[model samples]
Target: MTHDPTDQYLPRGEFSFLSLSIGAMIRVLYYRLRGMRPVRVGHCKQCGACCRNLHLFHRGKWIQTRRQFKRMIAECPEYERFEIMDDPGMLLLFSCRFLSEDNICQDYENRPSACLEYPTLDLHLRSKVLYPNCGYSFKMVKDFGKTMKAVAHIQEQAEDKEDADE
Candidate 1:
């Protein structure tokens, strides 16, 4: 596919609280159906888009750099980058210190908790916090429509239970 340089620094829409809640529901269903699948690794193609465009929230604030990341970690070492919540702890963010002009991680094997959990549907939901420029969110929205529907279904079930109890 042809790369678009403009996409590298574009401001994508913010993820709503509802979207995140639904995404979490979908993630639970995904794990129930499919145990953590071996993530298929792919060469990034060095678009530099991920690094140039990211929305990271660390230590009660949004950040986008190695320095900020270090400081955030220092301030709240217990906080995990959301992306690495799955198996294999790794920070997955749009930008990386090792990222060259070509958009490649200098330290691939020992990257942060976020980098290790790329491409998962849950990760896509949190993309607004990491790589907002990448088209992964759009693709995930399309691919996981059913999962979203299931989330709605689960919500309805919970509401019904509450009403029945009343």
Candidate 2:
């Protein structure tokens, strides 16, 4: 299948508080049903890459136009800390204003949850790629083959119980 570069900037679906919440719940349930999970490893290297290079999402999609960005900022005043660095037509890139020259967050103590929870579990579930030099990485919580076998055994037992009852 041909991959569209702009596809990465598109929202997975229509944006709404309920939709996002339900999407996250579904992702979690999917992994649970598969008897699989992702585990984050490593700690921040303080490279400042995350803060220096950010892709902002607004409403339900990547900020594609300046007007959309302005609307986002107007709705989220705290987003003012991020300054647009480029508009490559399909996407708008931003960088944090509080990142210091020494590769530190000047407002670390008051940083947004997005910053504090960098490399969130959703990133792993969505298979989002991180910076090449990023210190964090994700690994499966259990061996895929083993997990699948266990899930199959549980299903078989449930079927057996139903048959006995019938």
TM values, all candidates:
0.35, 0.63
> Which pairs of residues collide in model 2?
none
CA error at residue 25 for candidate 1, angstroms: 1.4
lDDT of each: 0.44, 0.65
Candidate 2 per-residue lDDT, tens place, 41-136, comes to 665667788788776666656577889889988988777898889888877788899888888677755676456556655544444577788777
lDDT of 1 by residue, 1-166 (tens): 1123243322232233332345555754574464332122223344556444344554434454556766767875533332221222234344344556655555554554333333333445444343434443332222254567778999999999999999
Can you give the lDDT of residue 3 in candidate 1?
A: 25
lDDT of 2: 0.65
Highest-scoring model, lDDT: 2
Q: Candidate 1, 36: how far from true, in Å?
A: 18
The worst-scoring run of ten residues by lDDT in candidate 2 lies at 1-10
Instruction: Give, for candidate 1, the lowest lDDT window spanning 10 residues.
Output: 80-89
